[model samples]
Target: MKKISQKNDKMTTVSLTQILENGIWQMEAEFSNSQYYAAIGIVRDTYNIPADTHPGLDPHCHHMVSYGMSGYQWGDGAVNYKGNRTEGNIAYKDNQIIKAEYDSEKGTVIFSVDGVQQPVYVRGINEKVRFIIYMCYSQASCTIRSLKKLIAPTTKHVANEIAVQW
Candidate 1:
């Protein structure tokens, strides 16, 4: 794990992680503010570290899912990067845990707000997906509270020769 920070402590921050195949990935972020914006992104590659208050992913191609005072959307590259609202819902808001859990075995990613699953953004994301947490526009901020990656459980075949006890 690397110690990454936002370019400006008062405005915005970007935290990125490499998604490993055959593993389960989970990231939790704490957000506050009603006028500013907080969002999450999954990129095919790493974003330029130490993002400023500019409020968008630079030098990286990503699929973004934003949830907060700014509303919700699924976009490519940045927050409201397209200037258009897509089909999505505002999953959560101030002082809540926005979580992302990835299952490599199923090639699926799940987003939840305060432990309640929202919806699966999309399937078949790259095995090496880049996870990003960002907040921009206005004086709001977001913190990457926790990030963990665990090996997916494996199933073992049992032989019928083993006696069964009821």
Candidate 2:
């Protein structure tokens, strides 16, 4: 487990390792006591925490997906990119689980909270990936309580008692 703390919003940090191909990567995280906005997800290049860059808005870097206190968005760029307000306004609080499943062959990405799938899906992202954690303002803390990777089976295993509908 690794702990990352930000006294003020000036820099962003990325994981040293890259995500595995055809695997599901998950992390259990806990936000700090700050009332400000924070974010966590997979990112490549880094950007200055938005609140420090611009007031109110916490813009995301291009080619990443993050679930922040404000909302969840994905795309490419430092200032302008593709994103949307996550459905249900799902935000991470003191403790929550963030999961990302990458299908290398399909070039697809799926994000989830706890165990339920988040509607944010990114396709055609066939490049290597890394994890990122950041905040848009001062007084924020985020901890990666645990990290795990599950390599999904290439083929399905069916029991003999099961009937094949097809």
Candidate 3:
């Protein structure tokens, strides 16, 4: 588990070193002092993190998809992102678990709060991506609890036996 805390007022974004490309992956994080702004999501591996800006809201960048604890989802860039407060009304409180799952096969990213899945999701992601977390206000922190790849389930067919009467 890794904990990321911000000491300044500027929004700070942090991303994992591992890049996920063609598989199903899941990440779970816990936020503290998230009353103001704290977000968890994914950013393209090629995205360059700005000095001080939200990953999803960075005007100069358009390769991010973020879900905030304040009940909002952001995709691409601030200019053409898809989401708002009303669409993602599942606000999370401090210490609540936030889960993000990405399926490269389906080209979708989904979010869940405290085990309950949210209706809002981001799609059309076919490139390599990395998990990211951001915090704005001072002393705001997020702890990455787990990051793992889920195995895809396989399908099987069974044979049925029948009895014939002569």
Candidate 4:
């Protein structure tokens, strides 16, 4: 692991593997002062990246975005931004996503996410559904964990997602 800073020297690395406990992959991010915090994003046909050359399909596609959360002007935090039709071609805005696709028979919810253009074989996400995927520029600093361990999982008030598991 690499040290995050010269001041405190916190080791840092984002896990590619889902940290599933009961049966899901849940992420929660919060804010403090919000100059910019550590963040990761998957590139796709969106974000001005060309479709054919889009990193959404590439396993090595990881980018960085930013946000300022001091005053919560953007409601700045981990966002799963979605665009509306009247907002022109791109409708989704920046948001924090807490979505899940569960298996009724197997009794397991989706523990992974579809990279930008990568085909997801989730139980419900069919190929026809459209999702606007984007990157995190800058964001607040907060501990994010699976909901099984959440003391208080954020709701739609400050967070945004497609579906809620609970």
List model 4 lDDT by residue over 5-68, tens digit each: 2122221223323333332233333222223323332212223443222122232233211111
Which regions of candidate 3 deviate over 4 angstroms?
A: 58-61, 71-86, 153-166
Per-residue alpha-carbon lDDT of candidate 3 for residues 24-125, written as tens digits (9 for 90 to 100): 888889988866467777878987777776755546236666666653234221111322322433666679888888888877776777877666666678
Which run of 10 residues does model 4 get worst, by summed lDDT?
A: 83-92
Q: Let me know the TM-score candidate 4 reaches against the reference structure.
A: 0.26
Where model 1 places Cα greater than 4 Å from the true spot, the runs are: 1-13, 34-36, 46-86, 151-166
TM-score of 3: 0.79
Candidate 2: C-alpha lDDT: 0.49
lDDT of each: 0.50, 0.49, 0.67, 0.25
Judged by lDDT against the true structure, how good is candidate 4?
Answer: 0.25
> What local lDDT score does residue 55 receive in model 4, on the 0 to 100 scale?
21
> Where does candidate 3 have its weakest 10-residue lDDT segment?
157-166
Mind giving the per-residue lDDT tens digits that candidate 2 earns over 31-91?
A: 6753535565555333333333322133443555555653322212111123433333245
Question: What's model 1's lDDT at 62?
Answer: 33
Best TM-score among the predictions, by candidate number: 3
Model 2 TM-score relative to the real fold: 0.62
**Clash pairs for candidate 3:** none
Q: List candidate 4 segments past 4 Å from native.
A: 1-13, 16-18, 36-59, 62-140, 149-166
Per-prediction CA RMSD (Å): 10.8, 8.8, 11.1, 11.9
TM-score of each: 0.61, 0.62, 0.79, 0.26
